[model samples]
Target: MNKIHYLMNREVNYTLSKCFLTRLTGWEEVPLVKTDACGLVLFRFNNDFTGLRFKLVLNDIEILTAAHIHLGMRGENGQVVAFLFGPVTRGISVNRGVVTGIIVESDLTGPLQGMSLLELARKMEIGNSYVNAHTENHPNGEIRGQIKRF
Candidate 1:
């Protein structure tokens, strides 16, 4: 069965290490990093699900910032897929057909709207790649995710 695993501290580190320049500046925040960057947090997902973005509603098409899902480790192929959920247009199907949901950091109030783990590839799912600034730049900075066990 497909597993939709949310982003975790461990997974965030995995993506940062790949960036040749991330180590020096640290994996903190690279101001200029948009949801469009190669990594998960770099840029927003196609509809939002591809990155660590959050989902606002289940039945309707809505998304929020702050994706909880973490980018996974790269496999033999760095496969990435963007599953975005924008406002539905006229002549479009709703409440039924597959309407890709954008990932976001909303609370339990919001849930994913599109492809499940079984439907998508391992590397294409949403992962942690959210940043605060828009134009700021990182010369070796990074955004770290800390984890504590109970």
Candidate 2:
């Protein structure tokens, strides 16, 4: 697993390019847990004529986001391969398909911690940060999530 840490002093933006997508592994049936501070925002997309795009909302706003992921492969084949995120509210299930981009917002006014950067941000007890996910698999770099905090 990769790890990235930031003693954030300003707002940061992370982007996922096509090359980044090619290197992403271990993204199957991953459970995105919500923490006391941050939340996971997943963007769903499709290539079909009637392609669908929507946000998979987690049920509870305060449930800590944590889970072990089993990454899988996606191709031209059209199948319902979605990563089930959060133990959200009753009847409000959150899932995304054919992820095109993901960006995590780390709103920090102090220090942070967690299993991964996302986990740390989620569990953070300070400012607001958003993790925008285009794919379910967490990216690898000097830090996790390919993030940059100013």
Candidate 3:
């Protein structure tokens, strides 16, 4: 019983230590546009590696439309794997706020369809993923950042 408890505690600590962070800015976007918008994303994997909890904070953004995690390298575009924010009405905007959610296997789509959360976490570990924030002014992506483990 003591051995089992120790193993469980170790797993919990390991999960808590698996964190990724990214800073979003327009300059990171392809065909970069000038904008005052910026944001940050934090991703943490669950104990069982079956879910990803994320928090995205945006500032000075306008007419916000959506945010997503994409499977791609820096300076490249990729298909969306998970939606972080609204595909809401185009007129909606945010000056400053936070959007938090958990992404599971079912949330995986596009090229990530049927993939496990562990697969996505592995992608992030290797710098093959990015977070993109979309706005009315830049539907493609107003701000972008490469996800990195930290």
* Per-model TM-score on C-alpha atoms: 0.18, 0.17, 0.87
**Model 1 spans > 4 angstroms off:** 1-70, 73-135, 139-141, 146-150
Model 2 ranges off by over 4 Å: 1-54, 57-70, 75-85, 93-150
lDDT of 1 by residue, 93-121 (tens): 22322322433333112222344422222
Model 3 is weakest, by summed lDDT over 10 consecutive residues, at: 9-18
> lDDT by residue for model 3 over 59-150, one digit each (tens)?
99988899999999999999999999978886466789999999999989999899878778778888999999998889999999999987
lDDT of 2 by residue, 6-117 (tens): 4231123122111111112122113332322222333322221122122323322222232111222221111112222332232221232222323222321223211223
Residue 121 C-alpha lDDT in model 2: 28
Q: Among these predicted structures, which one has the highest TM-score?
A: 3
